[model samples]
Target chain A: MNYQSTELQHQLAARFVVGSMRGLARRRFQRLMMDIPKLRDEVAFWEEHLHELTDTIPIQQPSERVWQRIQSRLGWVQSKTETTSKWPWFFGAFASLLLIVNLVMLIPADPVIAPSIERVAVIQSSEARTLWLIEQREQRLEVAAVGAIERLPNEDYQLWMLPVDGTPPISLGLLPQQGDVILDLGTRIDLAQVAALAVSREPLGGSPEPVPTGPVLYTTDLIRM
Target chain B: MTTPQTLERDLQQIALGDTAAFRRVYEATSAKLYSVSLTIVRRTDWAEEALQDTFIKVWHRAGDYTVAKGSVMSWLISMVRYRSIDLLRNRANQELSTDDFDEIPATDTLDSSLDSLADSKQLRVCMDELQPTTRQAIQLAFVYGLSHQEVSDHLREALGSVKSWIRRGLESLKRCLQR
Candidate 1:
C-alpha cells in the first residue's frame, strides 16, 4: 500500500477523504500517506474539493479563550502556573527534592497510593530533576507529570517498557500532562523480567509506530516496593 | 480581511517564527475551522479541543505546506476535519444527522466567502455531474464524516452498494474536477 499507480493512489485518497474508508483500511491508508508524499498530494486533492461540502454549515465563532489557550500552549502568553513554575531556583538542586521525597515516603504509610502500586519509577532529566512519576499496579501503570516539562505544544511524551530479554521496548502509552494516565501494560510483560522504563518525545499522539521513532529522552530502572 | 494569497504568505512567514503572521492566520481561519469542528464533533467541549489541536498542528507544521496540499484553506480544513472526525469516533456519540442533500445542493447555501472558495464552488459544479444518489452519498460521508456502513444505513442501501456509489462518485468527481 506504500505507492500505488497514480490512478489507484487517487482512488485510495478519494475513499479516505470521502469518509468511506474505516477500520484497518483507514489506518493502512494513513500509514501509506506518511510514507508516500505524492499519495499525500492526492489526499490533498480530495480534501480540497470535497471539504467544500462543509460550506453548508454556517460559521460559528470560537470563544476568545480558544485563542488564549492556543497562545498559552504555544508559550506565547504564559499562564499563571507556567509563569510561577519557572523553577529557576527551586528545581536547581535535585538532592533537596530527593531528600523531601524520601522523608515523605517514610510518613508512616502511603495509604492513598499503596493500593495502586507494586513498584515505582521516576524519569529524570540529565540535570536529575524528576519529570514523570511512574507507578506500577499489577499489569497497570500510572504516570503523573510533576516537573516543568520542556517540550513543544505539539510534542507528547510516550512511556516504554524495556525488557530484560533484550526484546524491543513495548509502548506503555502517552505520558500525561494535565490529567491522570493509567496505561495497561497487558499480559505480554513479565514483571520479573522487566529491565527499565524509558520515555521518548513523540509527535502529538505519541509515535505512530510500535517502537520509538523519535529520540529516546530518558531511561531509569524500576524501584521495588 | 486578507486574501488567500495573504494567508499563503502568512504560512510562509509563520515558518520563520513570526507571531503576527500566526495570529493573522488563526484569526482569518478559526471561525471556519470551528464551524467544521462543531459540525463533526457534535459536542462543544470536544469541538473546542479539536479546533485547538488543529491550530497547534498548523503552527508547528506550516513549514510542511506546499501547493500540492491544495490551498491553505483546504489544508487547514483537512486538518480540522480529520481531527474532528477522530474525536467523533473516539467519543462514540455517533449518529448520522438526517439530511438528504439530493434536492438541496450544498453550494446553494454557502456563506459570504463563496467568492474565495473557488475550489469549493468548482467542486460543487463538478459534483453536479454525479448521479443524485451517488452525489448524496458522497456528500453525507464527507460533509458529516459518516463511515461507509453509516452511509449505507442512512441511505437504506446495502453496505456493498453504498460503497460502490461512493467510490464511483469520487472517481467521477475527480475526473470532472481535474478537467
Candidate 2:
C-alpha cells in the first residue's frame, strides 16, 4: 500500500502501462504520478516502452465532423468564419447554384438511365487502396469494387451510412470482395445530411444487430460530383 | 503521416492559442487517434465522442507537452486511451453489456503508415519476438483496452494466467526494448 517503495512503484507502473491498474487503485496511481516526480518518471518510462505498440493499430481517419465539433467546442467557428471572409459573395452564389443543380439531379425516377449521379465516395483500405466505389443514384445506391480485396474466411465487409445526428450507422448491405454488386435502395436516402460512409468487418451473413458488430475497417466522405 | 518536428512545432503554437495551428494538429493526428478510439470502443459514435474529447484536452493541455513527456503522438494516444478505458469500464459496470465486446479477427490490419516510422519498426521487431498467445493478450489489452477478465474470456484462459501472461509479456518487452 506504500507508494514510496521502489518495488511497488515499478509493479504499479508496469500495471498502469499494461492497463491492468483500474478503479480506485488506478485513480490512486494517477495522483501519485502527479505528486511524485520519481513516480511520474517511472510511468513515463513505461509509456515509452509500450507506446509504440500503438503503431500496429492501422491509422483510421476520423470523420470531418470531429474537427467541426472541436471547433464548436472550442468556440473557434467565429474566428474560422472571419478568417474566410475574403471569399466574395459571388462564390456563395456559385455554391448555392451548385446545390440547386445537385437537388435537381436527385429528382429523377430511374437513376441508372438518368444522368444524375450527384455524389460519389471511394472507400479505400488503410493503405489508400480503393476498395469500393459508391455513387448516389436517383432512388437507389450503386456500388462497385474497383480493387482486388481478399475476403477473410467467415467474415464479410458491411457498409453503413453514418448520419449527422451521430446515431448508430444504418446498414447499406455487404460490399463485394471482387467485381461489382448494386442494390436498389428503394427509399431515397438524404445524401446531403448523411455524414459519411463506414465499412465494418462482420460475420459472413453480415451484422444481425442493427449496428455493426465488428471493427470498422474504413470510412470515406461522400463527395458531390 | 506527421513528422515529429512538425507536430512538436504545431503543438507549441497551439499552446500559444493559435487556432490555425490547432487545426493543423487536428488534421495531422485525428485519424490515428480515431483509429485507436474506434478499436477500443468498437462503435463509430463513441469513438467520435472520445476523439472530440481528446482534441479538446489537446487544445487545453498543449502547453504541458515537453520532450520529457514523450512524442506528441504518444501523448495524444495516452489521453484517448485513458478516456476510452474509462468509457469501457463505466459501460461494463452500468449494464454488463457484452454487445460491443468481441474478439477482433486476426485479419484486421492496422495502418501501413505505422510501418514507415523507425520506432514502429524497432517495436515490431521486438514484438515479433513475443509468443503468439502472449502477444495477442497484450494486443487485446493495450489496443482494445480490454481488462484482464475480458481478455481471459476472449482468450479462454484462466484469469490468473491472463494476468501472468500480460505481466510477463510486458517484462519481456521491457527487456527487449531496453536492448
Top candidate (DockQ)? 1
Clashing pairs in 2: A58-B110, A58-B111
Model 2, stretches more than 4 Å misplaced?
Answer: A78-225, B94-103, B106-120
State the TM-score of candidate 2 restricted to chain B.
Answer: 0.87
Please, what are the lDDT tens digits per residue for candidate 2 over residues B35-151?
888888887877887788788767766888998978788888888887777666654454223544443634133223335447546677777787777887887788778788877
| Cα lDDT tens digits for candidate 1, A1-225 | 335588789888888887667644665567567657888888877777777777767798998877876675564564443221111111112322342364357335633322224577878889998787766667766565667777444577888889898999888778765323446566777777779988888886779998999999899998866
Report clash pairs, candidate 1. Answer: none
Q: After aligning candidate 2 to the native by TM-score, how far in Å is the CA of B168 from where it should be?
A: 1.5
Docking quality tier of model 2: incorrect
Please write out the lDDT profile of model 2 over residues A1-225, one tens digit for every residue: 677798677778888877878864665566567656878777788777677767667678887766775664454442232221111111112222332354356336423322345577778778887667676655455566656676564567888889999877888877766434344455645666779999999976689798999999899998876
Question: How far out, in Å, is residue A202 in model 1?
Answer: 19
Distance from true location, Cα of A77 in model 2, Å? 2.7
Candidate 2 chain A: 10-residue stretch with minimal lDDT:
A84-93
After superposition, the stretches of candidate 1 with alpha carbons farther than 4 Å from their true spots are: A80-225, B93-120
